[model samples]
Target: MPRASRLAAQLQDEYQAEVSLEKGRGGVFDVWLNDQLVFSKHSVSRFPEDGEIQSAVNAHLAAN
Candidate 1:
């Protein structure tokens, strides 16, 4: 599966939150929650590790 599809599945299964993926040029992969950036591959120059984004989302959900 594609990265977005994989992450979307994980998020949907775990949190039941709505997820959408947008295609970007030049290898842009970003994850956003509630208009807030949770992960940005471009910024870090690397993809998130396993559970990295999930953890971020979890923290974001907990904080709100």
Candidate 2:
């Protein structure tokens, strides 16, 4: 599955505008912020402080 479909619901729960992932030729999971389509291979898989995936979800919400 692509990051967009997987993360869209999570992003929606926290009131993010919109997000989608673009798979590069190398098959990296890039994180996109809004339709402007910024790319990152950082694999936003963990943020340990808050102890729940929703916390990490909310942090990204606050970010954008």
Find the candidate with the highest TM-score and give its number: 1
So what's the TM-score on candidate 2? 0.38
**Per-model TM-score on C-alpha atoms:** 0.92, 0.38
RMSD from true fold, candidate 1: 1.1
Tens-digit lDDT string for candidate 1 (1-64): 2978998999999998888878888989889999999899999999999999999998998999
Inter-residue clash pairs, candidate 2 = none
Error of 1 at 54 (Å): 0.5
lDDT of 2 at 29: 49
TM-score between candidate 1 and the true structure? 0.92
lDDT against the true structure, per candidate, is 0.90, 0.48
- lDDT by residue (1-64, candidate 2, tens digit) is 5444656666566655454444557545454443332333455543222224445445666888
